[model samples]
Target chain A: MAELRKDYILDQYVIIAQERAKRPSQFSRSPPTPSSDKDCPLCPHNEHMIPGVLEQVGDGRGGWLMRAIPNKFAAVGQEGSAALSTHDPLFVHGLALGEHEVIIDTPHHDMEFEDLSVEHIERLLQFYAHRARVVESKPHVRYTALFKNRGEEAGASISHSHAQIIGLSVFPPAVARLFDRAYDYALRNESCPFCDVIRREKHSKRLIFINKTFVCIAPFASRFPFEAWILPLRHVPAMDKLRKEEFSDFAHMLRKVLRRLGTLGVPPYNLVFYNDERQGMFHFHVQVLPRLAKWAGFEHEVSVPINPVPPESASSFYREG
Target chain B: MAELRKDYILDQYVIIAQERAKRPSQFSRSPPTPSSDKDCPLCPHNEHMIPGVLEQVGDGRGGWLMRAIPNKFAAVGQEGSAALSTHDPLFVHGLALGEHEVIIDTPHHDMEFEDLSVEHIERLLQFYAHRARVVESKPHVRYTALFKNRGEEAGASISHSHAQIIGLSVFPPAVARLFDRAYDYALRNESCPFCDVIRREKHSKRLIFINKTFVCIAPFASRFPFEAWILPLRHVPAMDKLRKEEFSDFAHMLRKVLRRLGTLGVPPYNLVFYNDERQGMFHFHVQVLPRLAKWAGFEHEVSVPINPVPPESASSFYREG
Candidate 1:
């Protein structure tokens, strides 16, 4: 009973083993301990605190502006052997094997990601692409998840701005499901679902910002308030495929939208990158999710979200601001 | 763009409307507001604060021991017309037509659910069953979700002990997925997956408690730490089918397991009921999820949980404690 369990019906999986389980009291949410420059690990000149740096960008003053390194404490790593352990027909198991990398947004402890210069942000994106490619090339890694969690509510413990890229051994269930649906839809309709969404939302009220190569919109089925997606006008299945201009434009639009949210006083937010090397049916996209609500029992049990903000309102807000 | 949107890949739905959207600044988490008997709305003498009572259980006195009433603030309701709105191929919408009911566990405002007498717990369960059946009988309701949120982290705003039953026009995506999977399994193997799980887990290390009619276990794929399930030893698809003694035994086992978690200092938890009217393809059960961890980006993006606690540890902890 100490392994991953697949839902009998859905493609979802949960790790049920208690190898690192803590007593309940230990997991309680306590007031966040404030961080100062003296004690902050991600601060400049504190490389000793971090285990190692995988990559770094020069600040032009003989100091690093950004860096990427292995997570100090990772949920999964390549150290574990990847083995399947199935007990009975109902229980399925696999050794959690993957690499977790942290992309420090800036060496400056106080700089917000949205305020970073375009060139600095581009460098960060390059680091993400570089690390993702490296991890995805590993023998057991099947997918790479790139995401950023900001604020304590978003589960960020350190005050530093950073992003994470997890190289997962298995294809995440949500991605798998989306791929299957895309395949089925392509087979039946001879078109990509996401492309069609872009087309349908192009001139609509849900459009937040659109450029030559990218379009950002509040998704029709947004699960969170002010949730938005940045998608390429042209089909691209992977992040590495982005041309120079597309990458610059993507960073620009992303930062602009996030800055708008910042002006609106949005708290902890999450940005997840969804891309694949697979062709035709899939389209690469970035989702910007504002964490404004607490999901309770109804949502946890049923997987259905009751979003209070309409996409139209979010789009209008983003547009006006 | 203001409607429920079904996921293009998964069987998930999200309400994408601005009916009750709060400005980003309004959603910051604050310390819980303390409640006193004098000001509590759910207290015995404050029936006027509630809209209406659907069902009530007497304490053999003039006052009620438990009561079920329509939720004052409902996410979905019968007020909206029942209709599906499809906009283009990617965007889908639906009118949220449903009912929400709150089942007060006791007339006393200060009673803890786990500390309630066994007889009182049984009466509460009966009230849940009655309210669920009544709601399911409505013209538009296809399924009813019965759940309890204990403590603030679990999303309980009121200190009073109560459970919720939501009658929905549509079967929740998770429930729908479970049913489809169960049906497919039954069609292929001619057996119930849950029944098989019960058999496989019986007398195993995952078992916490077992009576002649029910068996409680820490699920192999627990999404939460100390998560447990109470399944009937005999195959039963609906909660209402239980006999008097079986119902009492179910309450006994549920209370015992929850009390064990309480002793271990586990805070805020949720209990969800999974039952169906469909024959052969379903088996009813209750899941007790201890909210020991906050779900973050990876979980939000992939819907896969990295549970740290093993079911064996949880089962043993409950048994020994």
Candidate 2:
């Protein structure tokens, strides 16, 4: 409702925004073929072409079943320190200090991650477990984040199904803040906030799905459109700590969630797993966010307050599936 | 590379990632257009059709220069104190209590934000000066964030060039950490970190343009490509504090940066203005980030290590312009 310009005291130069405007349609879509790489480099033969492989399981020398390799173009690699060396507190710089590994699921070139059998999930879990164990002990690594970024909008570069490991020398302030909030809930209510959500969503009957083990639901406050989360029925900190008995349902439920998104016409998405070193309540839950809508600049500045399609409205749509 | 399925794993039901697999590119490149009148309520004539319009400085009645309106779809709004109401020491959640107001840049339908005149920028500053004065007094509001979301990828919903003001009752932890770092820096160096950047970048050829009062540059470790920042030459704590004399450079530099981005073939981006209420030395600065990438799940779980066009590269590229 505001005019482009204010006839105020500071108008000594041209204020470009005063005349800038675009129609409603301009703010609604993205350019086709976004400027990004389309090459599939994680293929069995293509693997050697990417960043060099760090360690592998099955080269016949030892027939190892897994391999950890650096990301061809890494955001942050296995370097840097947690030392807050700069005296300028507002801006601190150091090596990213973490490991970025690409886990090739199989020699196969075209299978989808969700299509991987239960056996595949187990090996991946083991890989994550071993990686976590190794990185957790490193002098600076306070937390090791194990996640899979599946689509470009969700921040994936290579079109390969691989798990990424980032061993942080220092705790991410945002994650720590969230942990503090959840832990506070546990402390005050003697229950996990997420644990309560699992129960509430299940009993609410507005539920999406349920297996003997895992629970999937569109959160009451879905920050983005069609955001779904995978939580273990009960509280288990890390994927490594997942009980042998809980394996099948967890696998089934996780795949179903991803598959459901595919069915919903949502294409690109992201999966983030949180690990809490302090609580050991390092819940290895999975968060799948569908990029059904664009995240404009307003959110970067002021946390977004978007409400086109609410989560509840979107959940039932998914529930019918 | 690791196999999706390992031979020795006890259970095979885990959801494993199959690297080198096909990743479907699902996003539609065609810009999404608003379908009908129902689809676009932000149109100038239809704006009142949205939600709450707090205040205005228009033709006294309606044909106005500025009006603060509530977002129709808000991803982040006040949760009030009910959900996070305890004085718990372990976790934190106060009011998501924050203000969200959009500053419509122009009276025209197709004009973008960068088209405003120098006179317009000054008056807009005056209006913000008023809003800041009034909102800062509200209950629970600890800080105020003023920012603009440009293109759709930058998260603009209406294609209209506009900026927003958010007054938060509780500081989002991510911002608090910035202040913590700032304070830590102050304790060590006995001066403001932002001021230090100002001094350093000014002398450092990274400077894009600076009038007698304002200085703009691509920062030392920019997280995104083509990221530019406009900081007051002086160490002022907030934007409303600027004197009329500082207007010339502020307007000139801000426009130059936007024009440069357009020339770079990366016309879309987001501009964020971060402010901390509790700090004494952390001054306000507007960070103009090129909308060249998105934050995937890994970025949310772990702190980001943005690359593929480093800041130095971006700086060198922008400087040539």
Candidate 3:
């Protein structure tokens, strides 16, 4: 029998249909074609291919270990007026005014995210925090999104290990909804909903990993087959607020989950960081969504995903040798 | 420069970033592997492979033109209890008790949806309407989703030309949101928002095809590159409410838009029909979404799509010889 599960905080729901489930091995695909260093823009010698560098993390080797640069094909930029205009009650338009930047996670062209050491991953997290703060401080910026897309299927045009930061002039509707839900939950229950989720899931079958600072769990309403959420045990509202110890734990937990995911042919996935600086009640987290299935008409039409694998099963897979 | 556009009725928004746009010709992919009739279950002589036929449309040749059967690997079934259970505030769940069926669109193995004649397409639409009515009449079914996935990338596991009808026990969150927005809009303006959309887009530059009964247009806030919507001229809330002439015009319009999409190497796409039996003010329509680009980290992070091809450009491409 199929079960419908609701998100902990949001009104979102997903159908967990175990009867239609397939083994993790059945979801693997041929590896993405590797990119060579000869023309890879993010490679150490090819840094000139990218535009202006916004930030860089220096290594002891008198060179940068990572670099942040403006996206050559930015979806949103600072060149336009950010004013909203209404041509009619039915037609609304505005400039997508803000910034888009790419953070090259490593100088090596062949290094995958999961292969990075915990210290290296921690530095990358710090870089993401720094960039988020910088982008959020911009005039008219309302929200900043940080995410990493691995593999071609996951929408990475470039195969280099990297992440993106986008500053938006307006709060994205979905992100705004999350904040609204959190605020309402806090007002009603006098506590953060995500904090409650961490407490409830810490010992549940869906729990994947836990550390002193962070806990990873397969959400009850998993949208994808092996989707995992890494949340801080403490009530941290934004990436910039993360203490050094928290970052280390987050890095370790993330790497453990990603390494386990890699055992399944390193399937393409997206790592999305959610935070809201304006909403103090918001509990920031990172969602690792494996692109194991294509979202067809049903998902687009109804916005209710039918996840074949139960999160409990996925947790077991992650915990397996 | 990138511009943000809002959906006419919903709070949804999309970024039209033409600066990163690709030409329609550039979006083509290799054709999908054709399925042979010998092993294709939906082929004319392979009816025995499917368990039971729920409905069939006669072809006047002592055979059927199309058929609807229960999905063998159904996501939901009628066996389970439909009662909701709350383990805690953080974990709410219920049995997904409903129906899943597949409507094989044609008896021929090689015919693509665009290759079907307008009359044949009309019969297919009529069959869809019949199945929808039957499914929606089931007890506890709150929503019926009708959609077709044309290729593997669009989530079609089989190579046959077929559409799926899922009768869900709960109103999908996204579909429910659409109804809520429409109801709110009607209350504020005393007019159906979709009806207003038809009036406004009939002469807009985004208009693709218009007839007396139906009109097709590239929506202003198209999430996909070549997204098109087909709406009735009248405020018809459900499929059963569509008049004969409206069905004819809709078939013509849908065939035309799909044929145009087919010219672009028949890139994988989804055709979704939106209707509500309970919401009288709901003006139903069909959305044709071309899966030309992959939704990566940015999209998953904020739920805001960055469409490379503007609707106006897509409209011009559809209108071209």
Candidate 4:
């Protein structure tokens, strides 16, 4: 082989991984769909079985506020669940190990974030804020990540109008990176990188949307095609931190970003919240990935993506809107 | 809105971002293509631009081997090269940031990783090892990430067979996480967690591939759908630390892994390397990913993925070979 090896930061040397973590942190495997046309628990008639369904605007019955319930197939083990092994970090031999929940935002089954009204979105934001606070307080929960998958391309299997939250004692390897950086950044920069990002997007150009309390824009360096960021113009760390008055603007900006993507003709989408608000190195930013393009080796290996449609272009489109 | 603020790690909240930095990185603010075309750098270009394309057999010409080069359009900026910037970090106003370099493998232009030969795959491995050493030697380089993107859906602009190496002064936020865990794991266990993983995978029934020098399998706790790990049966810590005799066996194992994938069906894929061979957190390993899926927020936001297909099933499919 080239008698070659990789160089580590500590000046140590070892054989380069001919690939990335040949381990399982990759997120792109899909199971085959069952032929049976079973009723999806989150679907129509099964509504009552869920925690509760809310209607705000147009739920066919009325506008749906949002639905909160115990996720049927939660990744995290549920209350009284007993199939998992012990939660030992030293010995990671256990069930997937954590809590998984589904938050059905709308009952229509076909409606997406882009289709939600401003009022609906505002109510959804309220739910997100409330749930985040509640989830984070749960005992044994070290990290709470809330997210959504929009189309089949984006890995959405249920195809329901909803978001999900996960509470875990152990932070996955991915989140650990952010925590490390945020700690370091805070030590060095004396502030959060994301907070700084919010400021720059506010006073500067590239402003996609600016409501009373939120600003949306295409990031300076988007790693994907037509990627965007929705930040609280006021610089709140977590999605749960928005004020009651600010929730409307934050939700408004989120919808604005999604609506703009609809106009952009992107396919499925995924949203990730880097819960590390940044003691300094961390940026409390929401990476809104429009499924406009696929990610292959270069991206997975290097942790950087070659976004063809630069973020600025998307920002400009938002400016027009 | 719920008077409930989401709490993230690091005490640094959103308030600081409002005052300091707020500018989105930077972009050309242009949209070049909204459609796909066949003429892409990522496409197989056997005789067109590639002169000495490596091959697996057929007098080293027919079966395509691995190839690499400087990316025509890199995402991260290059040092001393003017990248879009108007700020400072450690006295430098703008970093020579942005990713660079591109590695093309497979010459069929129409062929993907599944179509390449085993030795051809080995040559690709040889290339990665060499590049890691080369990039690490560069001055001002803080981190070098090696990754691949297979299909257009995977964020690849070019259709040619290729991988890339992006050198960064600021180690990407994702990678830093491994180092932290390694440190903590080492401190707690008095050894490396990867070492623990190696020992555990070996002892457990979860093990997949085991040669005289390497072990490949689905991790006991995989966070993604088909995430797989390729590790040396033994641990030397960093990539450059690999001994002389182990190269060929390592190469053979890597080749075998890909060769078996062809049996799984032609799927888009990516090969990512953590270069975690640092004293602080270097754990030499390769991540082989069949670009078969997408990150639907759960893996990103929740640190968990609903991996419906267990590793045992995936292993059984490829293990026979």
Candidate 5:
């Protein structure tokens, strides 16, 4: 379904399926060690390891299916005012304010997202929406990033099924650029660009899975091998706007795509939720970037990634048994 | 030496050494295995393994100091025309036209860049400039990227010491954006922003090593821990413009800083050369990014990286015996 796709508004290009240098089998690595429940801090009886629980979803058996707690070693803190100041023309900075929290997705220390049941995943999605709303409500919070780092290679310090929500006082430049590009596209096209993308990709070769509410596809301009994007058919600006009924479909789509990705040796990957608190003409979606390859010097300097696996081939692998 | 610094023109911000999350000692990793010369394709006697040598520097001992050859598995090819075309509004692509070549830095398979003599490194630098100029002479080529992938974590496929040059028909979006920002700064300040940076940072805490011709500093807003930028004292638009006398100082500065970086167990890193082929109002420099930590979901999504080690602390480490 996908070919080389340029960024809708930017000059960035990802040369898809034109020339694949490596296949999926070439990316397999040694399996990661799973943490035992006895010493795992995220396990059920180790609540003392964390500062305090911010929220939780009870399992109706005196246990919690999910819990939200502040990250013990937070990257950003609410210690200082968010106002930016300049030391000089070259040195400008603001306090690393706002909040960083973790949502324990399951009680089982060794469980992964693909192992969780659809109903359990749906509840997790609901929790994500609820907590995102809570964090965005903070006065200093300007942008909220909800994402999961699955394994060691994906930057997860603790080997547990969990996700993190970082509330930033400053609007991230990448998201700002996205907003600018989307606004410009809307002005020119008279429609949501993402909606148009869905309409076009749903019938394309890169389509992996499509349901009534959500559609998953290997993005034409995938930066990484097997990179996939899951988008809602309806124009949802942020996770908090999704209706109660939409959670199940979204959860199912996420779980299915992730399970397919498991075919790649359950590779370490990042699942990122792109949501705008400002509710601009942004399309909220989840991007799954598999850490199958390391980005080297060219990628960093040039900023254009050469994806070795074409989206069509990646989609075929995802569609395989 | 470093503090929170913003991009000269962009809204991007990098929080410098405000938090000391982990020390340099904490970044120690297992030593990398050096490939034996007998089996290394880039070894002195394995010239036949590569397609053809585009250029080589004689050591004057019936051997080669450095050799450039086409990459066997090039990411882009010169078979197709460089014209960009769009299949649809969403599927725009162009031929990945240009060249990808590797420079065998040394015949000694076990050697690292830090182990090379300044004179030898200077020769390699000369070779880099020569190849870049040759590549840019092609009618379709618009950009040239010269870089080194030191270890596996830094995305080096072979254990042998080497560097790569990628010539592209299209200008990279990141570099283009950088030019735009620099251009804006010039328009407003009537001077190059990088020249101002050099002037401001010459005696700053972030200064690592400086010589008559080149100065190396830990950038105030580094994305990676211990990230360093090596720049010429005089504003040079590209490597080809470097005066012959400047190469010695540049080589020495690179070697000394890299040796300092070796104190952290010689952590895998990427050395990227930012050269503008168009010879616009740009400052040429080399960026060294140590791969000590993995970039997780938040970094990928927000674009604002949370650097655990401050550049000031990094500068101190680099300055230590």
Candidate 6:
């Protein structure tokens, strides 16, 4: 039997498939195979293989620590054909007119995020905010997405540690739905829904870690086991709005969470950033979802997930014995 | 470069990632390793392993040809704790109160849908409709989902040709969004949006097969490579409402489509049925989605797919020389 759980605030539903409950040991898969560095285009000395570098961060010894470059095979190029702007009743297409850039997090090819130091992670965060600002400034670009796919199972074709930033001509539907929900809640309750979540989560067993600047918790209706969320204590609108102190605190909390996930031998994870829809209508947060199970026909059709492990168990796991 | 395509009528969007376009050969993964028949619970004579048989179809000789049994590890069981009915400010949960059953399409362990005869397929459809009616009769069960996961990659753990019927207490969000769209379109145009889609698709190059009772086409905004849809020529509200003649025609069309897909070496696929939402406001259809690519972080966050192959190419492949 399963339990149909609803998110504390959002309209998201998760079917806790207790009947198919999976233990942590069941999630252990073979470690990712390391691709040879000689043939890797993202490697340090092979910079010439890429079209060109967009940005680079210094390691303070006249060496580059991280670099941003155009994805050799861009999903949406900066210079594509003009947008068709078709509004046909039966068939519609538009030029994927946007910038798709890759941010190589480290020069060391095999270094994952958890292996990076806090200072290095902070520099990476700075680069993300910088590129986000640049993309958000583009005309007709309504939304920008910054995400990371960690391992091969999570869709990383390259073995190198990197994240992607994609600019969109329209606000994404997923974020738009959340914006609408938050706006509706604010109109009725005169408060931010996520702020209320943080307050209430303090009393729940789902709280994983909390600090002065950030709080991490396995969400009430977690779609996946060990699915955790990190939110700022302050009512921030977007990642770019984080001040120096806030960024430092965020980096610390993020590193701690990733390290905890590593202890469980779960590294193939995805991280997505959600900012307000440029109107400060919703709170900014980061969702870390582990790709433990493959979705079948039922999950795709219903948009409701059937999670095996409950968030209560995940939270307790994060808080060690 | 990539292109962004919008669905003909729905508010869905897909980014056609041409740069990552994969040929059919790239999708040829290892077939599922069949579990031995002796241990397979869904196999004939092993029916005692299940909780209890709900329905069965007999061959002319009186032995069972097909059977319907309660899923041993049910996602949503009939006998669970009661519904929580709680609408908490920050925590909500409901009893996953519903029925889940498996319709074993064949007694053979290695049988696939494309290999089944038309008559056998018709029996499976009949069993689906029967179980659907039984579920709908239950109080609080708002909708029933009938879906098939055909291969391992498509999330089928067992190598048996079977389909699942899950009764949902609330209208799923995916369908709810479609219903809202259809209702809004009806209010504005005085017609169902899907009807207009069928009318317009006739003039396009995406049509794959058409008959007196059904039409199959690669959807305009296909989320996956080789994604196709089958709609009734006559406006039908629900699958259960499908008359005997229509059911036969559907089974024939479905058989042809699966055979066509098999020719392309596409073995893993997910099929979902869309009914009238029990509101009689939307047109009924079946969507056939091939599991060709793995959805990464960007897709999960934005609800915008990045399809490698466009629908035009898929349509041509289905209509091969």
User: In terms of DockQ, which candidate is strongest?
Assistant: 3
Every model's DockQ, to 2 decimals?
0.19, 0.20, 0.88, 0.19, 0.57, 0.69
Model 5 share of native interface contacts: 0.60
Question: Least lDDT summed over 10 consecutive residues: which range in candidate 3 chain A?
Answer: A27-36
Answer with 3 or 5, whichever has the higher DockQ.
3
The C-alpha local distance difference test score for the whole of candidate 3 amounts to 0.89
lDDT of 5: 0.84
Strongest candidate by lDDT: 3
Docking class of 2: incorrect
Evaluate model 2 with DockQ and give the value: 0.20
Compared with the true structure, what per-residue lDDT tens digits does model 4 show for residues A31-120?
323322246667656766666533223456654446667665455553443232335554323333345567778666556677878888
Per-residue lDDT of A257-317 in model 3, one digit per residue for the tens?
9999988887899999987777556888999999998899999999889899899999999
User: Which run of 10 residues does model 1 chain A get worst, by summed lDDT?
Assistant: A1-10
Find the candidate with the highest TM-score and give its number: 3
Ranking by TM-score: 3, 5, 6, 1, 2, 4
Candidate 6's C-alpha runs over 4 A off are A79-87, B79-87, B264-266
* Per-residue alpha-carbon lDDT of candidate 5 for residues A208-287, written as tens digits (9 for 90 to 100): 99888899998878888889999999998988788877888999989988988887677899999988668557888999
lDDT of 6: 0.81
User: Candidate 5, A274: how far from true, in Å?
Assistant: 1.2
Model 4 / residue A24 / CA error / Å: 33
Error of 1 at B321 (Å): 3.4
TM-score of chain B alone in model 5: 0.95
lDDT of 1 by residue, A216-243 (tens): 9987666776789999898888788888
lDDT by residue (tens digit), candidate 4, B1-321: 000111111111010111111121111123223333255544443246433332222336554345555654444445464332324331122333534566666545666554566556555666776776677667656778877765555556566566777766555444565566567667877877777777877766557688788888776544333457788766665555666546666667766777666444434556777675344356688877765545677654543444444455556545764
How far residue A235's Cα lies from its native spot in candidate 1, in Å, is 1.7
